[model samples]
Target: MYQYSPFDRQFVQLRAQQFRDQLERWERGELTDEQLLPLRLQNGWYVQRYAPMARIAVPYGEISSEQLRMLAHIAREYDRPDQALLDSAQQTQDVLQASQPGLTLAAPPLKYGYGHFTTRTNVQFNWIPLSKAADVMDLLASVGMHGIQTSGNAIRNITCEALEGIAPDGIVDTRPFAEIMRQWSTLHPEFAFLPRKFKIAFNGSEEDRAATGWYDIGVQAVKNDAGELGFAVKVGGGMGRTPIIGSVVREFLPWNQLLNYTEAVIRAYNLYGRRDNKYKARIKIIVKAEGQQFIDQIEAEYRAIVEQDGAPHTISQAELDRVQASFVVPPLAAANLPSKTDTQSKPYQRWLAQNVRAHQRPELRVVTLSFKRVGWAPGDADADTLDALAQLADTFSAGEARLTHEQNLALPWVHASDLPALYEQAKALGLVQPNIGLLTDMIACPGGDFCALANARAIPIAAALTELYQDIDEVTDLGPIDLHISGCINSCGHHHSGHIGILGVDKDGKEWYQITLGGSDGSALSGAALPGKVVGPSFSAAEVPGVVEAVLTTYRDLRTSQAEHFVDTLRRVGHDPFKAAANGARLDAGHRTRQAAETASA
Candidate 1:
């Protein structure tokens, strides 16, 4: 919720105009594709399988109602693919499905006119025309939003925990620091074109809701024994072709020297980080290969930056105060009133239990509006939904909402007394599913359906599972489970951190999925940050839902109590039973396919 200064506003507008000129030149053939490529990428434009995609940064996941409305406008007006293009894309998908017969793939028709909420808290548009890219950028700039540095091998958007300021167990609100870092790194000439794309995340709470361990740089706010504010800086953590937990470089870096320390870390990586191969370009590779040497190099870089460079980036207390001012809790009419949850409706009770979380202010609550539902890709919101969300934010959440890393919207300012009314409105908008961390609340990416890099379609598998798990009681009984699906090894869906991870893979030109078990995002439910282990060979698209069901069934049977979560039960008992269940389901699916084939022949 950091307010853009006059300079910030002017800068964004100029950048948008600059992009418009670049786009016009490219259209006129004045610039080659090679020339326009980096320009467009730096502006967050990417040519995907079917159309151009735009990634708009929502810094630290904070977005205003006005910005949300602008996004809704962009989705409705600009995010459209040509009819012929849509038809061709659909044909390609149909052919892919036909290639694998006897598979019950839930190939929903490709969709547009919506925005996808990403794990990094950025919003993506799948079918925006390259021609309108400039126009979209202009509109975003008008609302203090832009796609700058959202792509390319630059430091991407800085992210923080959605509950940063309001989490009961928060050590310090990391938003101000994250914002400061964002401003410094936005267009830093030295690090703009690093060896590879870099991501940074911050978490202030006792729990790791931001998945900081899965980022290039993970910063956690901490205090020294003397109670002075600082940060616990971890470097080299990332997920993709390689999954590695970040190593703690500096256990306690003074808050004032955050930027100086961050510069040291990246500067060291820039000097020695691999550039010859994109595969090993991530800082994790350098850290993994060199270990202590890498840490020592960062230390040496820090010394040089401090001693030789004079630590030019040290934060001033006044600047910190200015940034913190924007994040203060908005004055609420019901702040002094006690929460009244006397409504006895079962649905309301369920929603309260699942979607509503305790706030730092006892009179308020943090409510998560579920985007995971049947017949839609998870985290996708059409124009109408986006507009409605904006209205909801205005009416109930002090005109602000935080986009969660899990691809949902968290209204952090919802009054405890307004829960019932808010629930009713959200339900009418189809955003009131009582499934926050449940199995149905899975995270998935726009897989082969849109992403050219995907090995298989992720949407169909997510759809199949969502359709299969419509029973709320069954989902709640199964308990909190992180079921993440990724189309490829990009880890866009953060599958490596799920308790049950499904990754789309290619086998002999047909779509197959690899199932992984026992991953964690280092949250209270999921202990420690680690990638899930693959149970067995990849299963066909048809077997995924059944395979997942089989695993859940095994979990239900083996769990000592309902309180025992999926990850916990899996760890206590072991992966053999879950692995057997998954393989058995695959065998059953094969038998069904054979039976259907015989019947067709007859």
Candidate 2:
């Protein structure tokens, strides 16, 4: 993890103070609500359906145990509890009112709850008060973290592989470059106000874990002809009302020129991007409208900057060394590891199969502590959970943890010998779902329940689907699946990239769901050059579960073998089969309704 320098700490502190002043001015009516809107957005504050929400960025998804503890503190102090507590007397009174007078409740009051993790690799507190926003900012800055530029028409957090430094097949450790961009882009006065929000992602590993193909500016680390390290730059990728896979702009760009090249690209977009319509203001729209001409303009601008001064294009060797040094993995003692088959516990075996991944170091492993539990929202965690995780990190994972774009936590450096103990601890914390890549492991956004912009509720649909797939054996039989749900067309859940994507929409003032099949985050890299397409007409929310089950059943019956993943099979056969399956399920549901009505009449 990159430690904050004195300058960095002071800068964050000053930003917090500025926000405090702005908040005071707004409270005093000196600044209108409209005036405070942009300011609050720049600071990652949003006026949601219920209350103000603050999104705290976790840069590159890396954090120390101390930082987790601080976040836990904020959750306890500022955020609303997930469940309201009742005193013993109140509980008894409620029971008596319910006509269950004999029922006695626990005496102790439960601890307060807090925030939820986001798919963007950040934490969001949805019920924050506007008055406490400044205090939240100060608390975050105190721990060298901030929500600056997390929202607004500026470059958002630069995301990368969660296991950046430890991926075995990675071409380069991407954290250094990600951190460099983070520092450079933070509060860049020139690009502060673009046509729309910009997102940049880098992927260093052979596996594209960061969904690079769906970002505004996506870079894949690759080796050039001379075996020199560089990036393969792709621009225009995004998802929303219009989802687009980014086009390749540069086959190879030297590592040193990354900053200059990115700056040039964004500058061109800033100059040429559409601003008249907020809906179409994204860079992807510009790319679509201009085609090759867009790339030509960017190249021309990049050349001009390069010719003007080589200084800005060059990253000093010393600076690179310093950033690289900050990410050094801690030493681990050699322990004779237990054999994989030694554990007869089915839960342990299931956990190992799902949550564990091979690490760069042979003796160490990466464990994904899943947050996708049944009945609970997929990505939510209370203050107590965060604190528990911090303790686990300190004891077993070198006091460091990484948050994943999949809305889960990653312990990046646990020894093989520590697996049993860690697994036990995780089970106690209710973090051992053993469904990392299964059907129940769905990604969903806080839809109508929290966000003001949502068309319908998303979390309930996600929960229903998760419950539908509760039989782990049946889910295992169904094989690897990526299910994603979004409240609206914003695609915050990356629904466009899931093998089975569900988008909540409003039809005649009723909630409906549109389903798409064959989407995968790795599709572009895996030779499928297109995003997922819709299967059929949007269905009512009540029909979603059966429709989804039918789609999975279609895959199971049609796939050549179990080894064929859902996306691969769907792509090979096209969406016709899944569409037919969904249609059949809908028809059956209608027939059942008619039969039930006829029986009631009789």
lDDT against true structure, model 1: 0.90
TM-scores, one per candidate: 0.98, 0.92
**Model 1 over residues 1-602: C-alpha lDDT tens digits?**
78888999999999999999999999999999999999999989999999999999999999999999999999999998899999999999889888766556456788889999998899999999998999999999999999999999999999998999899999999999999888899889978899999999999987888888888899988889999989888899988889899888889999999998889888888988788999999999999999999899889988998999998999999999998986767656542333344469888899999999999989889999999967789999999999999998988898999999888999999878888778878888889999999998999999999999999989988988888889998988898999999999998888899999999888987789999999988888898899999999999888888899999999999999988989999999999999999999999999999999899999
By TM-score, the best candidate is 1
lDDT of 2: 0.83
CA-lDDT, candidates in order = 0.90, 0.83
The TM-score measured for candidate 1 stands at 0.98
The 10-residue segment with the lowest total lDDT in model 1: 333-342
How many clashes (backbone atoms < 3 Å, residues ≥3 apart in a chain or on different chains) does model 2 have? 0
| Best model number under lDDT | 1
Q: Once superposed on the true structure, which residue ranges of model 1 sit more than 4 Å away at CA?
A: 103-105, 334-342
